[model samples]
Target: MKKAFVAFILLIFISTSRAAKVTDWLDSYNVLWTSQSKGSYDSMPCGGGDIGLNVWVENNELLFYISRSGSLDENNCLLKSGRIRVKLTPNPFINSGFSQQLNLRKGFVDVNAGNTNIRLWVNVFSPVIHVDINSKEKLSAEVYYENWRYKDRPVRKGEGNANSYKWAIPKGLVTKADVIENSTDKVIFYHKNDAQTVFDVTVAQQGMDSVKSKMYNPIGNLTSGGMLFGDNLKFAGTSSGEYAGTDYKSWCMKSVKPSSSHHVLIALHTQQTESLNQWKQGLADIVKGIKSNDDKKRTQAWWNSFWNKSAIRINEKNKDSEAWKIGRNYQLFRYMLGCNAYGSYPTKFNGGLFTFDPARVDSTLNFTPDFRKWGGGTMTAQNQRLVYFPMLKSGDFDMMTSQFDFYLRILKNAELRSKVYWNHEGGCFTEQIENFGLPNPSEYGWKRPANFDKGLEYNAWLEYQWDTVLEFCNMILETKEYNNEKIDKYVPLIESVLTFFDEHYRMLATQRGRKVLDGDGHLVLYPGSACETYKMAYNSTSTISALTVVLEKMIEYSAADSTKSARWKQMLSTIPPITIREENGKKMIAPAKLWERINNIESPQLYPVFPWRVYGVGKKDLDVAVNTYFSDSDALKFRSHIGWKQDNIFAACLGLTKEAQRLTSLKMKDSELRFPTFWGPGYDWTPDHNWGGSGMIGLQEMLMQTNGEQILLFPAWPAEWNVHFKMHAPKNTTVEAELKDGKVTSLQVYPAERMKDVVIMIKK
Candidate 1:
């Protein structure tokens, strides 16, 4: 018994040592800068709990732009709250000795210069922003709340891209001014939407006016903004200025008395109500709920627990190597996603909440900081799916709620679309849809022919693109498979989306021919599209794969109920086999059985290898998928590491080590901007989230891939690129392993029985 006790104590010491090594590895990736920023382009991201701020020190002033989730305006544009500028009488930031760092583990930004030190952090549990400053000598401080929308401003020719109107702006459309009030100790501001918003116009444009009252309108009577208050500060006066070609007004405040320490707080509130007094009360309540002494400790604790969940570290001893950069950037992007974990809505794919001034992204636009290319409330399912899929492997199951709930809240609006237009029984979600679940008015076409179908968007790139929503349905079911999460709330949503394809396609078949199914008793998938690329197609492989996989999972999930399982089994049978053709005398998956025109640069032929998981390392027909990757003409021409592209993902899934390494390296390469992960305006906007998301997915796939009961490790990972990773899998399992010198150095599997199922693919 004495010997056994000694052995147990030794094991505990060894485990604790190993855990410390992992945490130290993460600390090395923290971003540090020795010089001040030139502009917002060089800013560092800092935020939590659905709030995002771009922090920078320029021209002896510390500045940050505040942005919050669910702050949609009358035009359905997601607006920035305001900007805050901080200056000190003795201006320590003007000195040559300066440093700014993003502390990833504690989730805050730290800046130091001369004798002053500043720390900025947002509460992870509440909507509050905190700034703390300490100096050896007592110093006065000036705080400025800047607003660019102080007057009704006309959204110029191309500026409409920032809102729902796009290029089809209605006559006399302008961004309304925000109301600001200044008192001795605080300045309160907010933007309240007009009674009529884009939601109303979209409903009438889509011919759903009769059922408008029953629809859900997220922008109607909405108000969003916050108050600026501090411990020893009082309002000074007002001033006006211009920044980056835009005009603005400022409400100024000054320190009541110089002190060695200063603390400032900005409490933000957003609500949808017709009473302005009610909105003011909500803002006051946020300020009243502050527990300053406890909030910082709690926020830091949340970040610590978050980093402990999962991590991927590569070539830790060599920070200069490309392998190390990819791993570091992966964690940095994940930090950005974590900032919006509990958002009322899912993070936007175009830029999320980290976008900066438009002039910084494109010098020609010269628009406000609120300017992003794609409309604010527009949710493109194809791009949005890539943003959320990587969360599954990282064991961030709780973050998935924002996305799943976004669809649940809009389910009834989608169903109403089907009933009002086609008198159908399932939801009809378009490719480019609004927050209210209607087709974007511009994409729905202001010049539609009288006889055209009201159920379809007039844009060619978006027509017949209803299959993208199926990916979300699959993500919902995957959460249950990966984490054993309770998904009872989303079952109705999944059933409705699946039912749409089944009944709507059958109805189309009946209208054209006598039988509802093809001669093979399969659903006649005509008038379809393969990801806006293979247009006017028949039996699109993407649609077929989506229907087959979702139905099989749904049938398995509903096995306890005989009636639902039987119905889904019948629907599963009607999904046609994935199309294949002979290319250079080798079998390769086809985009569709037939197609008329190539509309865009996307290779949907590899759909079976990825999200659907029809072909992979542990699955059959591996060579056939490999042939398509190397030999398919369209795939070769379209392969790239640009925004929203998934070729790297395909290579990883097929276990093509050299190809996967080459493509993912380009995808993860540092951005041209000062911040390495502020990726691109490629095919979207700066800090393209889908670009980072695709990179995240590829790196995860290279490390591990799961096929039902089997988990394959290092399937596509390079043998010599030493790595330490912790990743989640199906059946509530986690695998933590270390690889060095082309061999597995250590392996730990939770729920020991799962150890038997893990197959080490790399050579020992």
Candidate 2:
């Protein structure tokens, strides 16, 4: 009893030593957004739609609201088909020592800006733009939701989907502007460019649609008016006429909550000024709805509660080391990933959360941040797998399931399509594809490539991706889930995946008569040019790692089913061995090394190290991988995406941690708003790019080792972190451990650690 209590106190001491909090000093409504300030550029957009939003942080003792500003146009729009959403995430920061208690709160939205900064509260449902502006001075507020249509009212249009065709802000609607405080009613006019008192009456208004119906297109649907889809709710509009000899515009709103489930047209707008009127009014409305302190308080409490669930104790002395930073970054990555994950499509590693279509690129109006799929760049299979990484441990699994289900359908559909197109020979699923199962137009052009018609991404089979899905499928199944047929169905799919690899390769003699996959030198020849060289040469690392994992899992599963044992074992041997060749003193794992110029996309080498199980050789070859990772020739290395260019940050962190060099991982840490919401290469580092790598923090196989089936607690914890640490392993759970002055102090496991014959080692 004494020992256990002593351990608990020591754990508390250790946890407090490295624990830190997120410093949220600003609200989304405080950053005065207007036309002159280009607030639209800072907002989330609808893919291929032309609308934007500028989030301003408005907060005080009265209320806290995210003042949204901007409009629909050729660039950014609130396309009706897109879901209007607001979300919050918490419990993200990981400490080096032990777990810390935290609380989290629910987040609310004040769609309009002119509200009391602190006293405001929002209901469950919000119209696209409701809660209007009624005052121009301190303590005044508004209640409204608004949207505008095309400027030159399309002559061909009948009442589109909206009640008013004249939704655009005509000159007469520009009355009753910004609100002020502590003064007689003074007109707070829009600032032409903040710091002045003027406005742009000519500035256009926004158009809202419940669906994305383009009027002109050769490939997509050519519907003009719009669809009656969205969070199909009700709405109200006010008279746009002279009032008190000035001007007046009103917006009436109804519950936007979906009756069934569809879309709706909503107009959002902001006045051209910043007095306290809008803030006060917004706050007053929120106050009326409030039953608690404020949104901030609630949000903070929510986040705090979440953090308390799991604490990441950090070794402060190891700060600035890449290993330490990677661990920290993993936490940050999950935190960033946790925020704003709402939409039919998926999150983007590209610029916009919904920032689809880069307005103009390569002299053409191209949509980059797309809605029908996870846009930015292609390869949803890899990135999608990564995006869901946070779910296995710390998240509501619904979104994760949605994303996985969508992709699983895509994979199955591709297979079915391949059976028809390739006559069941098996070979489809592109290296990159849209979330909607459409091949990328830029890479393959408007027509689906004849090779791709069979469903394979690269003409060559991406055997790795197939295995990755199977792994995920099994992960879901093994959790003792009730509805596990979803996993069972995928098992057969994986079996087929192995069959394809079995049939595709032709064995040939290489060094010492070892069997080698002959890209038939096709990669070096003509038709092979299409396959990425880096992926074409040697036995691809991704492939071999995947094959190994697949084979191992299949062998385990078949062990219980005698009928399939022989067949599974026979095929397992056929899976190729990873090719590790020496190049200039560094170890190089190749896809087969047959092509001339390896495309930058070939980064499967690290599969064995991470996402795959490969090697931790004691030689200098690790240097080769690291050097080549940062090698001058690596195209992605110089990309502006700060950190993610090199895929090895996590691996490197792991490697360093494994080597007990906590100093290296500490240096590469990145942060968002100084709270450790980290990720450097924003575009290149997406779901897995950012969050996938973040998984390193939770499953720290490097520091807290996991070999075979046992757990190795603190295999690489730095001396400073000896003060505190908390972690858990599968089966019989949680472990609270601590150290002081480079020596072990105490260790405790909750619910007891022995689940099976699983070994638990306290390594020296």
lDDT for each candidate structure = 0.89, 0.34
- Which candidate number has the best lDDT? 1
TM-score per prediction, in order, is: 0.97, 0.56
Q: Give the backbone clash total of model 2.
A: 133
Shift of residue 595 alpha carbon in model 2, Å: 3.9
User: Worst ten-residue run, lDDT, model 1?
Assistant: 1-10
Candidate 2 residue-wise lDDT, 484-587, digit = tens: 22356456655665664554343113322344433332111111221243533444555566667767767776788876777778766665565555656666
Candidate 1: regions farther than 4 A off: 1-22
RMSD of every candidate to native, in Å, equals 4.1, 14.6
Model 1: what TM-score? 0.97
